[model samples]
Target: MFGRTKTSGKTSTTAAATTDHEVREGAKGRPTPKRREAEQRNRRPLGSPARAAAVRPGASKEEKKAAREAERKVFAEERALQRQALVTGDERYLPVRDKGVAKRFTRDYVDARRNAGELFIPVAMVILLSSLIPVAVVVRASLVALYALVLWVIVDSFLLRRKLNRITVDRFGDKATGCATYGMMRALQIRRTRLPKPQVKRGEFPV
Candidate 1:
């Protein structure tokens, strides 16, 4: 009876040890952690902004200010690059309207020639000032001249559109929509002021 009791005690001790081992294992990996614990672990992990703010209270302000200055420098560089792209015709930074081979081709075509439409802005300015004159003859002549200039610009733009359409169709197997209008608009802008600044020099016509 005594030996049997001793054996029972040993078996109970072994069972208790096994149960403790299982509990330890479960704590390590078996079950999911409580929500609060999990969230705390996730919210301020190493290298996170929140972690940095918490761990470095004394230096955080200076670090933040330095970080902001760095961001500003990066933004300024990007802005400069975008402006340069506008002048150099860099596709990566070009606006949506200026992106694409057809658009580039149209721009080049318009830039290669001196358009009559470019004179419209200056001429209209002159006509406006002349119309302000008290003299009746000057006002009437300016009105007539304005009408003639408008008609001439329309005719020139139409011709340009037709030529652009024909050329695009020949080259690309189909005419690109809005390309003619795009070309005409660019042609009307003063050469020096054109965006995606004129890739081709005057008289360097595209084949």
Candidate 2:
């Protein structure tokens, strides 16, 4: 080092401005490190700093596995947050497909309207069970009724979708995007089981 010694020696030749623990090298091969200095240097890792170093690259299979595990942990946490939002109606964490005033209004409107598609499953089960009864007339009647119910569900769904589209346009204008199918699907779900946990009751709609 082109520097003077911290504490001046009697035989020093460098200027007074340079002062540090380092010995001034007038011309040298290399000075032998002191015992403590050598030990400390050996102990310290050869790097810039421990904390300041960038994240290590995935250099090994184990490291890659650890990175993947970290990524999976983050994904699981995000999914958990979204699930909580769905059940608890936490707006901040709700997916984009379920957000905005229009979507909320659509949900409320669908919940408020009584759609026949909601009853299709239960009615079908009843028809199937009734067919088990030992009566040809009863079986025929059940089959006929099931067909009628299916037709009614289709008609009701059509009406429900139309209603949802009109509501979206009326409340949000033509510029607003529509989610008639989403609203229709929600309508088929029982109110109690619907996600984002229905904020409004059957009669108390947002729009």
Candidate 3:
């Protein structure tokens, strides 16, 4: 029979104890972090809806009123500036009604001329009022004068168109197509009522 090997429980228990000590030593310096504290340190908030409310929300009565008032003030300021520019004929803020070098030249040409159409408004008012006269001779005379004046203005406009065409063709070449018509219309307007209010005075012709 083979000799039986001696076994000691002390040897087994000592080996297990040494293994446990090694594991504890490895984890001694580094403590496990708490989930709650880690989360708080790295927390992310939602983006800027509160700041957006100041610009987009006007549902309350006072807020709505304030928004409308602000809008009106802005509109009033724009109107005032536009009117001032129109009156002073500021080129930087000139309206669509009076933009472009061609238009400027047209205005200058019309203003410089001693045309019959300049007194058109008052003359037309007088002629229309006289046409209301019940007397046959006076009515007929006013109608004839009206026709004559219309004819004269038409003839003058034709001459004005030719002259503007010639001048513009000489200066701007192929771009004189609608400039004559534009100039003619400007010529017909009452000098006092023209918008962009004639920057050039009479006799101030621009080339």
Candidate 4:
């Protein structure tokens, strides 16, 4: 039966809802832990044997082997990242020789053009084979062709150096040291065979 005053008709709704186990509005369901108990729960073993075992001088051979393997794995992963960076032009992993905004611009400039030096290997090979043929006309023709190609390469290299100097000066406000040499070397290589492969396609010269 509802609790009600003898002289009142209204039911005691507050008395009906109240209970011995009722929780307060903002109370946590569980009791708060003591400071000491919290500290104990979070405590960790200091200088624990298991944690120090790997670095100890008297460590086991298995531990040493595991350490070495771990080192090699890290080294291999770094090398793989470096190799990929070379192809992708990732600055973080590129080697000392390949780093720099100026160098990147030089590479793009060289990659955009066709170089006569790229024919040196093939032409030289033909000249060597011609020498073995012992035919006067063949030998003479090959020599002349080789000479022409060499002259062209020299002239092309000179022009490339001059152009690189001008462009670097204009774009960078100062010519980058050794930029011409770096660009010329890269330009001399066959496009596909160049390391840190050409970033730009033919006719895609850097602005």
By lDDT, the best candidate is: 1
lDDT per residue for candidate 1 within 1-207, as digits (tens), equals 999999999999999987887788435645678998897677653444544544543666767677556666666777898899999999888877888888888899999987989999999999989999999999999999999999999999889989988887677655467788889888899988999899899899887
Please provide, for model 4 over 31-145, each residue's C-alpha lDDT reduced to its tens digit, 9 standing for 90 to 100. 8999999987776643434434445567798986776676667678879989999889898998888888888999999998888888788878888788777899888888887
Error of 2 at 74 (Å): 2.2
Q: Which pairs clash (backbone N, Cα, C closer than 3 Å) in model 3?
A: none
Off by over 4 Å in 3: 1-76, 173-177
Order by lDDT, highest first: 1, 4, 2, 3
What does the lDDT read for residue 99 in candidate 2?
87
Residue range 69-138, candidate 2, lDDT tens digits: 6666666887999999998777788998898878877887777767787788888999999999999999
lDDT of 3 at 182: 81
Model 4: CA > 4 A from native = 1-65, 173-175
Scored by Cα lDDT, where does model 4 land? 0.80
Q: Ranking by TM-score, best first?
A: 4, 2, 1, 3
Q: Where does model 2 exceed 4 Å of error?
A: 1-66
10 residues in a row with least lDDT, candidate 3: 45-54
- Per-residue lDDT tens digits for candidate 3, residues 105-172, read 77778878867776666787899899998999989999998888888888888899899988977877
| Steric clash count of candidate 4 | 0
Work out the TM-score per prediction.
0.62, 0.64, 0.58, 0.65
